[model samples]
Target: MGSGDLNLLKSWNPKLVKNREKVWIKEQELLKENEILKQKQLEITKERELDSLVDPHHKHKNSKKNGLEWMYSDPTHNEDYLLGKKSLDSSVISKNNLKNDSKVDSKIDSEQTKKFDYSNDDPMSKFKIAKKRHIIQTKEKISKPTSPL
Candidate 1:
């Protein structure tokens, strides 16, 4: 190649290299920003989960503080128990209440009598009490049963 052509090639090579570096740097910056955004979203999700666990009254406060409008807007997350809707909160409360009441009743029964027959003939009553009794029996079995191994 000629001297002028060689010079031109050398100049163009550095420019091309600089342009490629700039593009790579911009791409890396974009990737970093995307990763940061994803991390922020994950942190927000974790915070919401932790908040839900720690504060059971968060949903109740949302309705009471923000009014029915906000609750209606986000029924899946907020005011889910308003009449016709079947809310997760309601199910959780019912299950917890059933557990607590059964525990209290069993404690009372144990104080009165040594042996308690938990069997009931009524299907609905049996279904309602079965889980609580199963839990109690499992706990007793764990505490009293001798290991074979």
Candidate 2:
């Protein structure tokens, strides 16, 4: 072989060059996939932020929690309930329907209260009780008259 051909043969490493190409291809594919995922995440966050701007209360309204959470969290709903008015019942509703809705709400409330069975094994039960107790103690300390030292 000529000197030029021998130099080319000596410099060529096919296995290493092929491995490098494979690694580069894999890196490019991973980078492209990562960029696509970032774009989708940004789009989802933008949509959620826009919805929040349009209706700040949509989260509470659209949440999939059990019916219990709305009572303490929704001030408007609580006020409506205190006023003996169902959310769907307008001011122009007949007195009979109003009474019927109130009765239904009362029955549901009673049943829920009666069926609230917090077990000792419940992981959050102790925490909830402790939180309430701490709140009560703080309120009591705040309300109590301090002795003149």
- By lDDT, who's the top model here? 2
TM-score for each candidate, following the candidate numbering: 0.33, 0.34
Candidate RMSDs in order:
17.2, 14.9
- Model 2 TM-score is 0.34
How accurate locally is residue 18 in candidate 2, as Cα lDDT from 0 to 100?
Answer: 65
Tens digit of per-residue lDDT, candidate 2, span 70-134: 56442343455568675545553466466668877887797588657759558798889899999
Task: Show how many residue pairs clash in every candidate, following the order shown.
Answer: 0, 0
Model 1, 1-149: lDDT tens digits are 55564644664464467767988899999999999999999998998799689878776653343346543331242334555576566778787677767777876776577444545667888887988899999999999969799
Candidate no. 1 TM-score:
0.33
Worst 10 residues of 2 by lDDT: 72-81
Clashing pairs in 1: none
Each prediction's whole-model lDDT (CA): 0.70, 0.73
